[model samples]
Target: MRAHYRGWEEGDGPLLAAVTVLGRTGPQVHFDGIPLIGRPVTAVETDITRHVTDNNLGLRFASRGDLGLYGLGVWVRSARVGDTSVSEARIGAEEWEEE
Candidate 1:
């Protein structure tokens, strides 16, 4: 699967993968080492970015045999400490005064 992006917001992005058939059998999606053939297809891999946030996203996956696959997992984005933009933050006290 592969994709390309050009600053579009939501509902836009090339197909990461689309295998209608694989090696003489119907293509399938796998989750956590299990085959998700008859499960309800619900999750998707999303890429999220908004001002000062440039990163990839990986979230929520499930399988059909899951009895209580009732929760989600993620390679979480850490609690962002502060804005990382250096150019936007002034260096001098006067920069913060008389504004």
Candidate 2:
């Protein structure tokens, strides 16, 4: 896992983010203690809804990945899963190789 602040807009200042290219999976992300999931990663979302609304309003997600617990006992429905996908995060840096 890695963090990358993919730049910002004119007034956006410094950015913050991460990226990890898995063996078979594409990119895996990680955060400090936990990430910020607004809503929930559910099968009920449509292409019209953006990630911001679904991954920043609930129990959020767990920085724990791969074998880590994915908000198992959490209340938020958006972060009750564990897999290799573009999960949302809030603060902190990611854990991964330098190159």
Candidate 3:
């Protein structure tokens, strides 16, 4: 699966990116490896500026059986590291696949 960020905060900060499927307890998949069932997902921390729409954040997986359609939810959290801090977040999702 793949995700794109069309709009983003104007400046740099610690960034958190995650995706979840409806009805699931955690993130949809892992960002660094082939995904399998029952593995826990973690938020990826990175530079927010790299998340533009052209730089697709994606995941790959191996499913043993037929997979049905499901909704995808994307979340982004940004936090400025300082004594007086600022934080921002956004969430979006859609019915994302067909089989």
Best by TM-score: 2
Q: List model 1 lDDT by residue over 7-98, tens digit each.
A: 44478754322122121132443435434332222211111112113323322222311121212221111112244211101111211111
lDDT of 2 at 69: 23
Q: Any idea what lDDT model 1 has?
A: 0.23
TM-score of 3: 0.18
As for candidate 1, its clashing pairs are: none
Candidate 1 lDDT at 12 equals 73
Candidate 2 per-residue C-alpha lDDT over 3-72 given as tens digits, one digit per residue, 9 for 90 to 100: 4565566998766644333323323332322332332334213211243345653233344422212232
lDDT by residue (1-99, candidate 3, tens digit) is: 222334356686433343323222324333224232222222232322233223554422214222211233333322333433222222333432211
List the candidates' TM-scores in order.
0.18, 0.19, 0.18
By lDDT rank, best first, the candidates go 2, 3, 1
Per-model CA lDDT versus the true structure: 0.23, 0.32, 0.30
Better of 1 and 2 by lDDT: 2
Instruction: Measure candidate 2: CA RMSD.
Output: 13.2
Q: Rank the candidates by TM-score, best first.
A: 2, 3, 1
